[model samples]
Target chain A: MDDETRALIDALVADARESPADLARQTGLSAEEVEARLADLEESGVLRGYSAVVDWDRTDETGVEAVLEVNVELDRETAYDDVARRIAESPLVDTMRLVSGDYDFEVYVRAGSMGAVSRFVSEEVAPLPAVTSTVTHFAMETYKERGVLFDDGDDDDRLSVTP
Target chain B: MSDETGSEAADRSDGTAPPDPADSVEGSDQSDPAEASDPTGEGETTAGDRFTAADRVARVPPSGIRAFFEVAEAHDDVVSLGVGEPDFSAPWPARSAAVASLERGRTSYTANRGTAELRRAIAGRVERYGHAYDPDEEVLVTTGASEAVDLAFRAFVDPGDTVALPTPTYVSYEPGVTFAGGDPLAVPTYHEDDWALTPEALAEAGADEAEMLVLCYPNNPTGATMSADELDAVAAFCVDNDLLVVSDEIYAALTYDGDHESVATRPGMRERTVVINGFSKAYAMTGLRLGYALAPPGAIEAMTTVHQYGMLSAPTTAQHAAVAAIERCDDEVARMRREYDRRRRYLTARLRELGLAVAEPSGAFYAFPRVTDVAPDGDDEAFATDLLDEVGVAAVPGSAFGSGGAGHLRLSYATGMGELKEATRRLERYLDGR
Candidate 1:
């Protein structure tokens, strides 16, 4: 991407709620220019979509989160894709990606409770024909997520000056 | 030869041998020139009394902007909007290049005109404005745009010549001209007209008699800029009056809303213009002390001669850093400019919301807001002092700039957003309590 486009993307990444006018003012581009460039970015898949960075812990419907390492017996033709797709289709799965090292896939699963997560892993995930083994690690506390730091109190970014 | 002999006779009459030019020249190679010129204690004089400053130097007042910084520094908890400097550090590539240069022991001075690579880079950059300066003949690297201003004034302005300058400026041009033995004729630009310099104002300031006209776009203190058509009119006036133009585009890269149009790019202006720009404001490279002047060959030669005698050259390592900045830091500069723009809009909007009459600055990182509503006697200095004393939010009085700036305040938004917001809050509370 061109520098201007890259800057535009950076601005959006920093604050997705910035209006076209705000983006234009910030990027030194006209509103129309920002709009056109944004559309181009969307078309090129450089900008997928914008979503809220929710503090799930603050909400009443907070879910139990765990990281699952799945070692799969790859079907030589389809590789790990077939087993990975099966695991991704589950509702409890928040994120899934093929990983290197001993694990074939690293998956993030979230459920209403710890029991639900455990039940899903044991009953659903372990039953997958290609899934050879699975290891689950539950999250204790999230200190930071998606660049937002929780419980960061009294952090003053101002420089110390006498005046 | 007669004048030299006459002066020598006068010196001998005073019981001090006349300084033999040859001995003094050779003595300079072995010892201090001042000491060599007067080796005996008979001519012993206090350092301060030995050399008197020129009348023009005495005529110029101490910088009001610097005084404000001192005041700000003296007070604790002062949230200063007084400084014009950017809070951001210099971009990494520029800093890294300087570090690399130092590691490689590249500590000696470069060409007095600056490194060829930097000059060429500058030429490439300014080409966007449609002025293709021959880097070899037309560019001179300077300590900063400040030095460039001093050099341009000294180069073009003869003693007692007048240099027309717009008021509510960067606070250096007037003194720079005065120090160079020129009179600075203040051309008043009012907030009523958004502070843009008009041709009428130029004529009213007596441009006909003025040898030069100083222009600063994305102007400091006022944060005002002229449109291309507005600049065209000013150019026409300069052409009509046969005035050399010293255009300080130091803040050119920080211009918002539209592209900055250099006065030199206008018709009939190239031959008579000196464009001064620097890395400080644009790339956050203030401490690097690097800047340049783009002028015609004759003007460049004149400035270069002054530069050679005065500074020799800009810092060697900084020049290398500037090359990196010019080549690889456009994206970083653009990023910083965007941040400044965001702050500008926020501060302008917030200041207006607090009932201050602020001309939303179209360029630079300052908001020139009228604080007459808050000042008991409509005094900007009093208002600024009171603001600092009461709320600890520091801002520069408009009067510090010039008479035309008497009722306003130059609030720099170069600080972070959090500080700006807090400063605004303090200002609001201070105003409300008053």
Candidate 2:
């Protein structure tokens, strides 16, 4: 990406909800210029989409979060993409990525409870024809997410002095 | 104004020269003459009378910039664009480092020069600008770039010497020179030329007779920076005139259009130049009071001598934090610069849209817009005062800077986007009424 586009993406990454006028002000471009560039970015697929970074723990809908490592038997004809696509079809799968290590895919899964995750792994994941082994690591707490620190209290300790 | 023999005799007995009567008169004249005459006056004794301040101290006017801030502070809901400080807190790593230092009880004073680690970090950072200095011998940590500028004046300026400073610049340079017992010669740069300090202006400002020249790029108030070719010309002039150059690069990191060129990095200029920089603008560490000066060993030695006698060393905890800033906060600094650049562009464009003439500021977070078209009497201070009173939008009068600043107003974009937008809206309404 060009420097200007990269800068725009960086700003969006920092705060997705920033208005085009705000972005224009920050980037030294007019609102129209910012709108045009953003349209081009969206059309070119450089910008996938914008979404809210919800703190799930703050809401009633939070579920058990776990990272699942799956070793899958690769098909000589279809390869890993087919298996990855099948696993991604499950609503419990939050994110999935093919891997290069012992595990063929690493997936993030969320469910109502630990029991539900265990049931899904045993009843659905383990029975897959391509699945070889599976390991699950449950997340305890999130210290940071999407660049925002969660627990650090806002206290400025620097001495207050005139410049 | 007393040169009474009783005082002079007392001074002479101590083998000190008699105080100049003319200087005493000039010193006492700034205050109420009645108070100076009456020792038993109810009012508090002024510092000038209590201590023997140099005559120049009395001549130095209180910073006009501070007066506007005081007026802004008196009102509620004022969207102040007068302050020169950044609104963002210091980056997390730098602040966390200070907390860690405090938790570890590392609070004692550091070496007279500074902590070795911080000096090393400063040396490494400045090297990117193509200047080199040995951390041990050539770097001295200071209490912000303010102290560095003061130390430079104290070390180099002698009585009756002249210090030539470009006009519409930061307010501190002139006073620093005056306090050091040197004459401050104003070099005028025109807004027509984007306030660029031309070689012709330098010569006209009496650079030949001046013992030192103070150059602040990405300047305060004006927000002007010299190009590489411009700097080369200024460097050549300094070389030909054998003038010591004290270049304040505090705003060096804030330049938007191009890389900042330090005069010290110029060929044949390093030996005679002292570079002043700090963590304030770049890392948002203004409250930490951490800055440093990079100069040749001889000049550093002289500044260190004055520093040791006065400041001893910069705050130890702040020094530790500064090391963290220099070593780890490069990304944070860049992030803040981008934000400032955005604000600079917005503010400049908005001011121009309001029918004022504004030069696109290449650096710093301020826009100096000519206010004569809207000002009632073509007085910048009056214009700024009226704006604050009418619309609660506070800006600094350019006259507070120096010569060639009378027709402009300096508006800072260090505030948030919301406040800046509100301030511009209010300013537009106020100007429309005028």
Candidate 3:
């Protein structure tokens, strides 16, 4: 049962929208097995969620994306989790991680504009009680997002036919 | 694809690096054998000319894949299941290491046997396959697995010695043997046996006369894989006959069901086997052209002798990248293998539903479907040509891979599942119209 669950998760990791039939074939489990296993995963929250990988720049509304490194001076009660929870309340935070080395937390900020991003960092984030120092490294380009290359440089370079 | 045949890169695709006559792809009907057999009209010779291709060079026939390439080249929207390489890119670390090698100015030639690090890596990689080779003496890295095959036959086989090649395998093996001055004895391995060479079949094919046996499995064109028990039988036969074995395990890591057993691991087989493997199929580094030969010291020395005098060494950047591939990219290899396995299952099931007899492929990316149901009288070539013209989908005729492969179409599952689904739809439509 756990084997099927792992296979399902692996297949889902490759293509979130993969049909149950393809998932079944890929994982070597029956369609019913896939359905049951997926339901189990969702029920247990082992499968977190499925979402689309979007490049906001390509869409109508352009956004500035940046990595905000927050080094917080935490008290005995204000743990890393508390800091993450407070910072994550802002909608600008796309992803938050309590990363080690050089920073206490790494927050990915994606906003409609550079001014919005700066405003969110200054007004909402920097003023936090535990926040000691913060560094903003704005991304000029998003070359890859969620493992998908933004460009077609990985085109097939092989000859039309080879043995 | 048809537009740029003059480049040096295109020539490397050919087994012997023959000049591509694909510029004629504009008008010539490649379906005609007479025209295709002499693609460049180089067969027309003049007595006064100073340069004539030697009998060894002229004797090797044009690969059956050439016509299919030309047919595919003529079309714009071809969803080809005819490719033999992996669709995945090289693992990120390997790609980055290649870039780093250039950035670090390691652009000069490597050792004739390859760099110490890469040779050690090759030794370690082959060690996982259950054979231990001395990195300094037993591993000889070549331009690609294709080159290692040529060097193996050339190093061991004499002018008239025969090399037994199983039918319906990689197209390069036969020509490669011939080019090395060895007569290739075609031992037909039937689809009934999953395209594997059995002891009885070997004896019937008079393999006892051959000095060496050539193998590729999980195979190309057929995707047949043999169990360790089956390999033990063949390995015993090789021992009894005292024949050398050149086993190409390029598709070894891509085996879908069960483990891929190397013939070298069999008793009495290690000393006689020259193990050829590469990053092309498994690591998706075909463009890098990195492969290695693991053999006994004597065989490696001979192959290196031929390699140094002719090809010298493999690309330095490629060697460094290969080390990184061996050390850091196993997860990437597994991911690619899983993807191919998924596509393989999808293609095989869909083709079977379409009323074609598909031997469930247990290895490699190909699904060899017998086309006698649609292609009456087993004329796969004509059937394939019609399939291309009737629909825009392209596939290689099984006859292209040699005997025991006739009456079938070798459809590759190397592309994306979406593309396979679309190709299968077109195939279903073609079948329905039939």
Candidate 4:
């Protein structure tokens, strides 16, 4: 991608809600060009979707999240793929990725409560044939998400008038 | 010639003002802070035949909005559009470079022209706006563009030589020329012309009498700018009249319309122009105080001589920081310029809706809106005061800029949307009450 295309992506990543016209003005691209590129990016699946970085503590939702490290001993190479596909389909799992680290998979799980998360791990995850050991770390609060910091308390501290 | 130049420079050095006692009283509304500190009035001994400020420095009145600043500061909820500054922090890489230099213990004074690294960066950076300065002899890193302006005047202007400054310009230009013992000639440009200085306006103001011209665009106080065609006319006028141009392009990156073209790029103009720029407004590095001047070899050498005496060099940390800023902050500047443009559009449109005539500012982050309809008796001072008192919104009165800026108010939009929206809402409420 060229610099302008990269800039357009960077801008959207920062604030997806910014208008096309404003994005164009920021990136030195015309609004029409921005529109054309957006469509192209979307069609090619390079630009997947836009979502808010929600501060759940401020919202009325009751959800708990945790990081789960699952150690699975695969009997065969095909067993790893079968286990990964099965875990990805679970409702409690937000994201699951295969890794080269100590753990076989680092899974992000979100459920209604800690009780629900514990139940998902005990009943759903460890029951797999290749699963060897499981470790779950509960997240207490989120200070940041999606590359954005929350409530930094920064304000306009400059004097009202200056030269 | 060397003796003559040396003697005059010495005269200026010796004539530098002793701290004026009256200077501290500039912004007091009722109570003097000095009186409280010295109750016995022992400070009165200063009046008896003692030397005062040099005539030129004393002639220009001090600038203040202190009374207003105090009043606005007292209010916890006041929404201010008064300061000309960016809302962003200095680019992280720039700040990190400063930290890295500090870690390396690079705090010693640098060469008077600044570190060769920063001078080279400045030479490269000015290329964006078409100024081709040689790093060795044609560039001087200054404490800030304020010092660069002063250096330009001292380097070129003889005592009593006139310098043409377009009115409704930044606060520093007029006084800087005077401080250098040059007469400031105020040339006017009106909103009818969108505040761009034409040859006609220059000629009408007796600009031929001046030996130097100061140009700032995207201008402060008034967000006026020069198109290439407009700058061509001004360049022709300067060339015909044998004038040196001190072009302050500090706000060059914030031009909303098109890319800024340095006047030095004009035909036969590079030899006679000094292009001044800084990292303050563009890079949001105001506190770092890094600025540069690009000029001909002789002029830069002369300015460097002045800088060597007053300020030996720009800070080493700041020079290093500016190198990082110059090399890496174009994307950040583009991002900021985009944000400022949005605010410019919103603020100007909102002001027009409130029954004011704001000439759509072409550059900078200010909108100079004529406040005749909303102000009492078209008095912007009273209007500004009443707005802050009644609605808790603070804006600078247009009259403070110059006579041409009378009946208007300069509202800087280099603030966040929340503040701009709040300030304008209070502005509308204040107008309704009036």
Candidate topping TM-score: 3
Residue-level lDDT of model 1, residues A1-163, one tens digit each, is 6655765776676678878865665555778999999998889988889977666788888688999999878666656777888889998897899977988889999898999999999998898877889999999888876655678544432222111
What TM value does chain A in model 3 reach?
0.90
| Stretches > 4 Å off in candidate 1 | A1-163, B1-54
TM-scores for every predicted model? 0.74, 0.81, 0.89, 0.81
Interface quality of candidate 3 as DockQ: 0.37
Residue clash pairs of candidate 2: A26-B342
The residue pairs in collision within model 4 are: none
Model 4 agreement with the true structure over A52-106: per-residue lDDT tens digits: 8878778899999999999998775657779988988998898899999789999
Which portions of model 4 miss their true places by more than 4 Å? A1-63, A67-108, A112-115, A118-141, A146-148, B1-51
Give the candidate number with the greatest DockQ: 3
User: What is the TM-score (0 to 1) of candidate 1?
Assistant: 0.74
**Can you tell me which runs of candidate 2 are displaced by over 4 Å?**
A14-25, A28-36, A53-163, B1-55
Q: Per-residue lDDT of B1-434 in model 1, one digit per residue for the tens?
A: 00011111212222232332212111111122343233222334446546433455435554454345445666887777765667777899999999999999999989999999999999998888787999999999988776787799888899889999888776666766766788889999989889999999888878777899999888877888889899999999999989999998888888887898899998999999999888888888765778899999999999999999978998899899999999999999988887777778768767766899988698877789998877969999889888888899988788867788999998888887667878988999998898
- When summed lDDT is taken over every stretch of 10 residues in candidate 4 chain B, the lowest stretch is B1-10
Report the TM-score of the second chain of model 2 against its true counterpart: 0.89
Give the DockQ-based CAPRI class for model 2: incorrect
Question: If both were scored by DockQ, which would come out higher, candidate 2 or candidate 3?
Answer: 3
Q: Predictions ranked by DockQ, top down?
A: 3, 4, 2, 1
TM-score of chain A of 1: 0.85
Best lDDT among the predictions, by candidate number: 3
Clashes of each: 1, 1, 0, 0
